[model samples]
Structure formats: structure tokens, C-alpha cells
Target: MIAATPPANATIASTGAAGETASKLDAIAAQIEAANQRISSNAASIETAAKRLNTLEDTLDSTRKGSENGLIVLAKADQRLADIQAQIDATKQTQTTGAEAIANVARRVDSIEMAIAKSAAQASQHETVSAITGKSADTASQPALAAISQQTSEPQPRIASAVPAQTGGHITAPDTAKPAGDRANDAARTDLRIAEVEQALAFNKAADINTAKLVAELQAQVSATQQTVAGNTDVIAGTTKRMDTLDASMARMDARIADGERSLTANVATDSDVAKLVAELQASLASLDKRLAGDEQSLTDNSAADAETRIRVGALEAGTAAIAGTTGQLQAENKDQGKRITSLEAGLASVSATAKEALDRAIAAGKLAEGKLLFETVLSEAVAEFAFDKATLPKAAKVELKTLAEKLKAENQNVYIEIQGHTDNVGGTAGNMALGQERAEAVMTYLNSEFGIPLHRMSALSYGESRPVADNKTKSGRAQNRRVVLVVLK
Candidate 1:
């Protein structure tokens, strides 16, 4: 207002200076952003390098531990192989001994057969001598033959003349003396032949008995040897299979080790490459730090971004751990449930089998037909029937009961027979219960005392009117319901 005069140079200089300052600030902001990007990239690369180093350390540690364990396992396997070889050697020795024994038995059997044949020949010869002797004696007894012989012999005529002095007979004393020496000789020969035949027969009988004993013993030995050979063969085959499996396992382990060595080599090369990259990143980070020092105002935004990234990484780690824990818990629950289901299924199958067997037995005994039976009639016929108040079993009932007891004893089956007493709904619950218990006790007592069945093998139980198989309102049903049942418990 005093002069109103403006300098044109001053205005132009101020405008140009303001424009240059704005351009410098924009260039500085771009540089700061590029530096922040380089820092973030370097930080991420450093984190990756750190993780790789930790992984390498863990891998090396695990590899060392596994190699130590493998050495221990290999030592154990070597010992097992040695033991198996010893067992095989012992088995071979046993086989050799058994084979030798069998050969010896065969020789003994052959000797026995030869002795039997010789004895039979001697018996045949004795039979032929006896037949000839009988024929010769018959011929000598013939009158015509005796007369011819006497006429032919000169001495015979003299003997006949000496015997003619006797009143109405031949010379019997001289004639008998003439044959006495020959008869004694023939008799001695026949006795010697009979003694030889008897001795041969005795020897043959002894040989036959010995042969039979040897054959039986040899058969037993052969059978035992065969069983041993079979067992040894199985053992050898199994051992060979196991050895092959172990060798295959060792081969696989060696292959894995080879693969691991290759992998370790690759990892070492990768680590060297990563180390070069880390060095480059560190050089770049140093350049970024120098540049950032010139533009220190840009550091606040980069620092905030790093803090946020750290928080996100921590959250991810926590989430991964939680998931692993949940997965483990679920797996454990699944295992427990699987075991429970298997147990229940097994129990159900056993119960079903037992029930089926019981039903089959009942049908075979003619106590049931098509799942139906006259309960009281079947019980009365199969078991001892008692009156409402009677404690003693009838003789006929005792006999039947004894037969059943004998059968059980003969089979050597331990059975617990529960005599369950039931009643009709004719009395109060208390009274019916008492009556049922009394009836069951009476039946149990009779079976034990009359049949010699052990008291421990029997028990009396009263169901009273609690478990009625038929309607209590009907007479027929009531009769069916009022009964004693013998249940065999396993």
C-alpha cells in the first residue's frame, strides 16, 4: 500500500524453488518405498535361510540317531542268524542218527525172516518122516508080508521050528526078540527127529516174536524221525525266508542311506547357493540401510509393516499346532472306539455260538421240536420229577438220573447243572418264591444223594412266578409254567 511495487525476479525465483523442492520430495518418497521393499525381501530371505539351517541341523541329527539304531539292529540280526545256524546243525545231526537206526532195524528184520524160513523147512521134513513111518508100520502088520519075509529068511525057519514045540501057538518070544532091536532103533530115530523139530519150531517162534518187536520199534522210530524231519524242514524254510526278508530290509536301508547321502549333497549345494543369495541380500540390505539413513523419515512405515507380518506368522504357527493337537485327539478316540466295537462283536459272536449249540443239543435230545415243546412233559422225562412236597426221588427216577450221571462222568465233562424251580401264579409272590426254592432244593438233594452226583456240580435256584413261559390265566399254561428245569452251565 505504501509503494505497491513488486520485483519480477523475486517472484520467478520463489516459484522455481518451490517446484524443485516438491520434485525432490517425490523422488525421495519413491526411493524410500524401493528401500523398504528391498528390506522386506531381505528380511523374508533371511527368515527362509534361518529355517533351512534349522532343517539341516535336524536332518543331520536324525540321520546320526538312525544310523546308530541301525547298527544296533544289525548286530542283533547277526546274533539271531548264528543261533539259527546252530539249530540247523543240531537238527542235521539228529537226522543222521535216526537214519542209521532205521538201517540197523532193516538188517534185523531180514535175519528174522531167514530164521523163520529155516524152521518151516525142518517142520515139513518131520511131517514127511511121520507119514513114511505110519505106512511102513501098516505094511509090517500085514500077515501076507510077514509070511513072505519069514520064508525068504533062513534064520526065520529055525525060529519057526523052535516055536512049534509050544502047544497051539507060534514062537512068539523069539519072534518078538527078533524085532526088538530094530524097533528100538526106529523109536530112537523118531524121538531124535521129534526133538529136532521141536527145537527148530521153538527157535522159529522166538525169531518171529523178535522180528515183530523189531518191526514195531522200527515203525515208531521211523514215524518219530519223519516228524522231526518235517519240523526241521519247516524251521529251515522259515529261517531262510526270514533271512531273505532281513537281507531285503538291509538292502532297502542301504538304498535309503544312499538316497539320503545324495539328498545331503544336494542340500549342501543348495545351502552354498543360499549362502551366496544371503550374501547378496546382505549387501543389498547394507546399501538399503545406507540409503535409508539418508532418508530416515521412511523407516516408520517399514517397521510397522514388519511388526504386522510377525503377528500374522505367530498366529499361523499357533493355528497349525492347534490343528495337530485336535487331529491327535481324534485319532486316539477313533482307536478306542474301534477296539470297543471289536470287543462287542466278539462277545456277541460267542453268545450266538453258545445259544446255537444249546438249541442243537435240545433238539437232538428230542426235548424240542421246531422251537416248541411240552415243557413240563420234556422236563419230567429227561429229569427227575418231584411232587409239590416230596423230597425223595422214585427208584425209576433215580435209575434214569444215575444213567445221566454216569454218562457225564464217562465223558469227563465238568457240568454245573442248575435245577431251576418255577411255579404257577396260584399263591402270593412270597409264598410262591418259598415253594419254588423248596422244590429246587429237594430235586438238587435227591440228585446228589441218589445218583452220587457231587453237590458242587449242582445248584438250586428259584425263579418263582417271575419268569413265566406261558399264560398264568389258563390251566394248561399254568401246568406248563409250574416246572423244574435243568440248565447246563458252561
Candidate 2:
């Protein structure tokens, strides 16, 4: 201190201070060097950690990409599955429709077969009746009478030879008187001849009548047979058409089923890929868990410096968590998409069922409309009633006829009326014929005047006792035979 009192030189003190500061700086530099080495090592470790984190992040990104791709593929697969399921449902519906159509066709085929059998039976019955009628008529005619005569007649007398009288010297013979038996025989023969002629006439008349009846019966039988055959043919054709439609529908269903099967097979392959992706994702998750455990242990070991490092660590953890949260959200979205696809499939099935029901109802309504039109047209042409005793309409009949006339006039159309009179066999032929004609004329006059039916549109016909429809032997039949028919023509 006494030496320093010699005078505190500023430069010297500054130099000393500079040396000490340099020394202190050198020590600080040495410590900083050590710190720098530690920091460099730490930086290297951090670089390595960063590299590992980057690698992990890249791996995570790859995993995330793969998971996203897998989810996208899963979504596609789910959509495809829905489409396949829809196709499968459609195929099932088509199969059901085809089965129903086939059943209907089978029923129609059975009806056709039954109609054919009935027609054949009726034709056979008609043939049998015609044969029996012919046999009975033949047995009651000339052949039986000839057989009776042959059994009752006696042998004829032999005539004398003319050459014998010349050889005995021309002896003259007196004419022999006819015997009573001969005369009786001659008269009987004449009566038999007349009776034979009468029998022939009766047989001819009967034959003619029988021939007409046979013709009519044959015609009716043929018509019935033809109608039955036509009906059977129509039924068969309808059945065949239905069967063809069913077959076509079945074919389409089969095709759809095959397509569904192919799609399911492809989906199974896709599911295998999805399984592989899940395994990879599990491996990635396990690796991330190991990394997180290492990070937690590193944080525990750095507890003295935890306050400073914790902020960075928390930031990194937060970043990793955010990434994980984003991945989770993506996975959730994929699952939701799959659900939506399933719901769409169910909706499509409902729509298909509704459409089929609507189509069926429409077809039924059209058939009902056509049937109603046919019924109305038939009713319009039908005869309501016939005249009481004559073809002539009563005053009440005229009133009813006028109503029809007014209806026709309202429709702006012409109507034709035909009056036909029939008589019972009780009356004489000429008298019945005259009465029928008079009744027909009376009806025509009423229709023309009261009903305002034009003369050109009104027609009248008289069928006498000859045209009786029922047996004259019975009172009920005779009453039924006496009638008039009124036909309305379109």
C-alpha cells in the first residue's frame, strides 16, 4: 500500500486490471469451452434426437399416409360393399318375382291342360249320341218290315207249261177263277204295297229331320270343341309367355348374384389389405410408445434442468399429440363414412320395394278399367225383356223403349230394334202364322210412332208354330214357346 502510494498511475492500474480481466476472461473462455463442448455434444444429441424425431415424424407421416390411404381404401371398400349388397338385394327381389311369375305360369298351364281334357271328353260324348240316334232310326224303318214279311208269307203256286197242251193234240182249257185265298192275298199284297210306300215316306221324313238334327249337333259340338281348344291354346300361350318372362327375370337375377359373388370375392382381398395395414399401424403405434417412454426417462434424468427443457418438451409433446388427434379424427371420419354407406344400401332396398308395389297396383287398375268397359258394352246390347203375348210392344213397353231412344239420342247415335214373334204348337199353322205377322206389324208400328225409332232402323219378323222352341206335349213348354224376342242392334 506504501508502494502504491507512490502514485496511482492510471495506465499501470489499467494494465494490471486488463491482465486480471484477461485471466478472468481466459478462465471464463476455458469454462465456456467446456460448456461449448457440452453444448456441442448436446447439440449433436439434439441433432440426433431431431434426426430420430424427423425419422419418427417421417415414419409417422408415412404411417399416417398409409392409415389415411387405408381408410380411403376402406371407405371405397365400404362403398363397394354397399353397392354389392344393393345388387344382392336386387337379385333376391328379382328371384322372388321370378318365382311368383313361375308359379302363376304353372297354374295357367294346369288350367290349359284341364280345358283340353274337357274338350276331348265333350267331343267323344257327342260322337256317341250321334251314333246311337242313327242306329235307332235305322232299326225302326223298312228293313224290319221286310224281315217281318219274309217270315209270314206263304210259298207261291207253280205255273203250267205252255208246250204240254200242244203235244196232247191242242186241248182247249177253260180260264180258272181266282181262289178266295188268292184274292185275299192279292188285296193284302196291295195293302202291304201302300203301307210300304207310306212307311218309306215316313222314314224319309224322319231321316231328313234326323239329318238336320245331326248336322246341328255336329256343328255345335265342333264349335264347342273349337272354342275349348282355342281357350286352351290361349291359356298355354299366356303361360308360355309368363314362363319366358320368369326365365328372363331369373337369368337376370342369376347374373346379379354372380356379380355380387365376384364383388364379395374382391372385397375379401381388400379386407386382407386392410388387415395388413392394421398390423403395420399397430407396429407404428408400438414404436411411438417406445419413443415416448424414452422421452419420459430422459425428462426424469434431466430433472435439475427440467424447468428450462420442460417448455420445449411440452411443445414437442403437444405437437405429437396434435398429430395423434388429427389421425384419430381421420379414422373416425372413415368409420362414419362406412356407416353412411350401409344406411344408403338399406334406403335403396326400401325404394325398390316401393317401386314394385306401385307397378303392380297400376297394372291391376288397368285390367279393372278394361273389364268395366267390356261389361258396360255387353249390357248396352242385352235385351231387358220380351213382349208379353205378341211381338207388339205394350204402351208400357213403348215408354221403356222411348227411354232407350232418348239415351241413344243423347249419345248422338242411331239404334236398331228387331221384333220377332213366336207361337206355340197349340194353334193351327196358318192361323199362328197370321197372328205372328199381325203382332210383328203391331210392334213395328208402336216402335216407329211412339219410341220415335226410324222406320229404317226398326225390323219385325214372325216365326209361327213351326219355330216353337219347346215341346208341345207339356203345358209349361207350350207357354214358354209362345213369346216374342226384342233384339237391340248397335
Candidate 3:
């Protein structure tokens, strides 16, 4: 009976050990549940960050499209201006040709007038001769006088047609009726008339020469004006190209920043999740180690006397082996997560470094020039357009302004900013100019008040509807035209 009592005591001890092991397993199960909940929470955070990234990408894309459209409009405007200049040049050329033709016609008319005067003078001399010779002279000179009258009565067309061929010298028709003395006197009078006509032609020629000089000067002035317009167009084109490049760079930077943020969020989540897992695992291992150490001493004491105790000890050893394997797996997972975290952090650092390098290169290369486009962004989405005819800021506008302020602060340069406002051709010029002015002033004020940018550092101006980025005939174009531009100067 005494030997049976000791075996019963051993059975009681084995049952107690099994109960303790079950309690430890239950605790481990609870820890795994907590870890799963943490993982879920981290997953939700990652999803939220991803949604934000998508939204940012969409906004960036919209801004890029707007810029592209603006560039297209500028190119079209340049082409139209060139066409207008060409038409003007053609008109100037036509006017010059017309003036030269008019001068030639006027000179021919003057020559004909002199010819008429000489013919009248010859007829008068014939009449006088007829008076001196009485009826005999009258009969002799009648045919010559009739001929002179007929020549004098000739239409202007005949003189105009004949003048060019005979313009090299004075016009002459030989007369047989007049005596040698009278013919000599007629010759002297004809020479005097020719001299007077030459003087008038010389005066007309000088006037034509003066008119040509005036026309030349006007043409030169117009050409210079056209050149000025061309130069301004070139400047605008260059500015647009620079803006495009800057927008691309900004987009890339934004993408990299988003990527970095995602990576950082994932790393933080992974790190936190791994940390909790490691803590739980270490606690489990510590508890298991203490229990196993106690069980080992119990086994050494009980194995020689109790076969059942030995079997129970073997079961505990197997359970310990399983727990050890789990611990090893968890440690490996932790190590791998740590490596992944390191790699992610390195990737983030590389992205930042690469962006910095690119910015430095751009600055060194003078891509960011004085009076060049530093940054450009639409005021808001189509649904959230700028307040028309009002000097108020929208929430989206504030965000954009904040970004610009940050960029300006980062640059830390002694720069002057020109804030130009534009609008669609929907209203009267005066109204549009007023609206543009209000918007420009609003931007400038916001920059000064919200960002601590000095008022003296910025100037606000309005171009009204004159400098539209798009056509005003369409709804979409009007929306695009209502914009603000920032120009930087050193």
C-alpha cells in the first residue's frame, strides 16, 4: 500500500506539468492575435498613403496638360503674328510701287503741258505774221496755223504716248511756211519753253525723290518694329520651353518624394510589426527557457524512479524542440525584415541624393536663369477655379502657394518675383484689366502674408485678356486663360 501511494504522487506531478504547458500555449496564441491586429492597422495606413500618392499624381498630370496647351497656344500666336507682319510688308511694297507709277504719270503730264504752251506761242507768232503781210500772208500761213491748232488740240493720250520716245530732247516738227528769221525766232522760243518744262520736271523729280526717301524711312521703322516683335516672341518661346523643363523636373521630384514616403511608411510599419513580433517571441522564449530549465532538474530527479515521468519529460522536450524551431524561424524573419528595412532606407536615401544632384546640376548649368521661369502651376482644378472678379484665395490655391513659398525659401536667393495675372476675353477691356489686377494683388498679398515673402520682393501686374494662353471662344480655353504667371529675376 505504501509503494502504490508514491506512484500515485508521481502521476499527480505529471498532470500538473501538462496543465502548465497548456497555459503557456494559450498565452502564445493570444500574442499571435495581437500581432495580426497590428499588421492590419499598418496595412490600412499603407493603403491611405497610396491613395494620397494617386491623388498627387493626378493633380500633377493635369498641371502638365495645361502647360502643354499653353505652349501650343503660344506657338500658334507666334505664327499668326508672323503672318500679319508679312501682310504688312506686302502692303508697304504695293504702296511703294503705286507711288512710283504716279510719279511717272505726273512727269508725263508736265511735259505735255509744256508742249501745249509752245504750240500756242507758235500759233500766236503765225497770227502776227498774217497781220503784217495782210491777205497774202494770211493765205500763206493759214495751213501752218491750222496745223498748229490741230497739234495743240491733240488729246493728252497722244502726248503721253509720244513723250517717252522723245523725252531725250525737245520735240520738233519742221515748218516750210515760215521765213528763216521767223523760224530762228520760233526755235529760240521753243528752246525757252523746253527749258521751263525741264525745270518743272526737275522739281517733280526732286519731289518724287523726297517721297521715296520718306517711304524708305517708314519701311525701315516698320521693319524695326517687326524685329522687336520677333525678339519678344523668341523670348516668350524660350520662357515656355524653360517652364516645360521645370515642370518635368518638378513632376519627377514629386514622384520620387512620393516613392520615398511610401517606402518610409512601409519601413516604419514593417519595423514596428517586426519589433512587436520580436518582443512577443523573446518573451515566449524566456518563459519557455525558464520552464525547460525547471523541467530538466525535475527530469534528473524523477527519471530513475518513474517511467511515466521520463515519458512526460520526453514530451516536454519535444514541445521545447518545436518552440525552439519556431523561435529560430521568427529570428530569421526578423533578420530578413531588418535587411529589407535597411535596403528600403538606402533606396530612399538614394532617391533624395539623386534629386539633390539633379537640382545642383541644373543650378550649375544656369538652367535656372535670371528672369527665367522658376515654377508654374495651375491655380486649381476645373471644378475649383479661381474666384472670378474677386480677390480671394481657394484652399487649393493656398496649397500651391505654400509649395511655392517653400521652394523660394529653399533657394534662399536675392530674387524679385513678377506676378502676372491674365484672363479670358469675356468682358470689356477695362473690366478684365481690373479683374486681373485684383487676382494678381491677391496672390502677391497671400505670398507676403502667409509665406513671409517681402512685398518689395514681388510686383503684381495685369495683362488683362491681351496675353491669353488659349483662345477665348471655347469654355475650356477660357478656363485655361484665367491663370497667373510667376517670373523670377535676380
Candidate 4:
């Protein structure tokens, strides 16, 4: 019997499967490239949006500064208006006081003038009475005139007596015919009295002129104060109108600020949405990468299997050719070699059985290796919680790592661990990536140093802000994002 051989159809089928796998790999690669391009485009869009937001923020800041300056200027203007109004009130009060004082001075001057007129009338009437009574009243008039002259020594103190002294001294008492010496003395007294009366009238005229001048000056001052008050009133009114305009402007500014806030809020929401979409795309890319890795692994396994099958087929063909040569030699050596042929046939059957057994052992080994490969896929994952902006492992994370180490030690087969680090979106992409890497490396180092796990069996990877399990808008979500995950593969 001829040694059993794998079918040609089986080889063809394996080749087709390999070709199909290669084609799938090419397709997956193209898809991954497309995804990368899309990611780049999305990143550019996000950058543009961030720039726009920054510009809007700057605009709002400028607007706020301008508004504050406007308020300051308005406050200063208001203060200036208050000062002017105060000055106006003070000026008005001064004008009123000056007017009252001037009126009082005018009243006093009028009373003094009335007293002078009344005294002059009394002097004339006494003169008339003395003339009508003639010599009978001459003796009485002489004593009265002498008394009046004594009383009117100071004209301001005895205005009524001043007029009598003036008239009586000039009248010469009608005793000029008595004696030349007496008449001369009477004439001298009359001249002196006339001189005193003329001096008093001059003083009164001077007082009236001074009073009028003072009244004129006061009126001028009051008129100037009134003008100043009027100007101040106009200034106050203008200031008030300006304040009204400022108030309206401030109201408009407030409205604009409110609108800006609303716009900013809407932009924030849009940014959140964009972040979610990016996250989803990143997750899809990760899934695709995982699938691609699996496919590539399957392809490698299939290729190895095909190479082994080819090697076995080549060995079987060489053995079959050798057996055919021996059969031909035996047939050529003897015509009646039937027993020998039977012996050769038995030996060939034994060789075929050995080959069959070896083939079955090889298949069993392949199955075992395949099972090991299947088990080598990701087995489990655990979270290593970390604080915000910190790469240090927490106590709980250390405990978990310890447990993991123990589990790894208990396992018969070698285990590999992948430490994946992540971070919130609080920092720049590059910074976050660096931080994530540090966290991942920290976890890997802990596994190696504390648990004695081999460095070659662990790997550190940083996803940064690209991968997120929760919304980054909330504190708790951001905390959750800043974490390390250990993926175990056995």
C-alpha cells in the first residue's frame, strides 16, 4: 500500500485561505489609515473651535474692562456734578445774606435822614414863634439859644438842637442894638453855629454817598452770584442727562454680556459633544486595532500550520520514492521472490503505521499549541485608581496589585500584563500623555519590584485624553479618567 498523503485540494484550500487573510489585512490597514486621517481632521476642527473660544473670551475680557472704565468715569462725573451743586448752593446763600445786610443798611440810613429833616422843621417853627412874640420872647429865646448851643456841641448826639443853634446864632438874638461888643460877640457865635451845621450836613451827604456805593457793590456781587448759580444749574442738568445716557449704555452692555454668556455656554455644550464624538471614534479605532491583531495572529498561525504540512508532505514523498525503488530492485533480482515481496510488504506496512502515529502526535501537539495561543488573549482587567494629577498608586491599587501578583504566581503558565494609563482633559495633549505614561510606568515598576514580576512580561501604554469612560465635565468623571488599568494575558 502506498503511504497516505494529504489531498491536493487541502493544499489549494489552505492557499486560498491565506490569500483571503492577506486581502483582509490589506483592507484593515486601509481602513485604519482612513480612520487616522479622519482623526486628524477632527483634531484640526477641535483646535479651530478652541481658538475661536479663546478669541471670544478675550473679546469678553476687553468688553468688561471697557465697561469698568466707563463706570469709573461716570462716577467721577457724578462727583464733579455734586461739587458744582454744592458751590451753587453756597453762592446762593451768600447772595441772600448780602441782600439782607444791604436792606438793613438802607433802613438805618433812611432813619438818620428822617431825624435830620424833623429837627430842621422844629428849628424853623421855633424861629417863627420867636419872631411872632418879638421882644416879649427875646429874653426866653436868648436862654433857649444858649442852651441849644451847649447841647448841640456834638451834632450826631443832638441833631434837633443843631438846627436851633444854627437859626438862633444867625438871628443875633435881636439884641445887636444893646452894645457894639455884645453885638460883635453875638455875630461870632452865629458864624460858629452856621459852620457846625454846614459840617453836619456835609457828613450826612458823605454817608449817603458811601451807602449808595456800598449798595451798588452789593447788587453787583449778588448779580454775579446769581449768574454763577444759573451756570451751575445748567452744568448739573447736563451732568444728569449724561448720567442717563451712561445708564442706558450700561444696560446695553449688561445685555451684551448676558448674550455672550449664553453663547459661551452653547459653545461649551458643543465642545462636550465634539469630545464625545472623538471618544467614540477612538473606541472604534481601538476595537478595530484589537480585531486586526487577532486576525494577524490567526494568519500567522495558519501560515505556520501550512509550512508544517508542506514539510510533512515533502518527507512522505521522499520516503515513497525510496520504497518504490526498493520494490523495483527486488522484482529485478528474482522472478520467484514472492516471500521476499511479502516480507517487504510487511515492512512497508509497519513503516506506514509508524508514519501515521507520528502524524497523529504532530496534530495533537498543534492542538495544544493552539489552545495555549487562545488562552494568551486578554483574560481580565483591573483598575488602579489614582488621584488627580498624581501618578502614585493608591493603597487600594497596591492591594489589588498584590493580589494580582499572588494570582500570577499561582498560575502554572507565564502571564503578561499590560498597564494602560489615562488622564483627564485638564492639561495639554502632550502633557497628559506624559503624565499617563508616568502612571503606567509607575504601575509596571511596582509589579516588577514588589511582586517580582518580570519586566519583559509587562508593558506600559498611555492613552492620555483619547480614551474616556465618563464625561470629563464633572469632577467624579475626571477623577475616574485619571486611572491606571492592568490587563492580564496568560
TM-score of each: 0.24, 0.24, 0.37, 0.34
Best by TM-score: 3
Off by over 4 Å in 1: 1-3, 56-82, 112-490
User: Per-residue lDDT for 44-91 in model 2, tens only?
Assistant: 544554464455446446545644654565565556556555655655
Q: What's the residue-level lDDT of 40 in candidate 1? A: 60
Runs of candidate 2 with Cα error greater than 4 angstroms are 1-178, 189-211, 231-235, 238-249, 297-490
Best by lDDT: 3
The candidate with the higher TM-score, 1 or 4, is 4
User: Quick one: ranking by lDDT, best first?
Assistant: 3, 4, 1, 2
Off by over 4 Å in 3: 1-24, 51-55, 58-66, 135-141, 154-276, 279-490
Question: How many Å off is the CA of 340 in candidate 3?
Answer: 62
CA RMSD per model (angstroms):
51.5, 65.8, 42.6, 21.7
Candidate 2 colliding pairs:
none
Residue range with the least summed lDDT across 10 consecutive positions in model 4: 373-382
Number of the candidate with higher TM-score, 2 or 3:
3
lDDT of 1 by residue, 29-77 (tens): 5655665665566566656655755665575576556556655655655
Taking the tens digit of each residue's C-alpha lDDT, what string does model 4 give over 136-249? Answer: 635644555554444333443443323332232223232422443454465466456556755645555565576567557666765765675576567656766766776676
Better of 2 and 4 by TM-score: 4
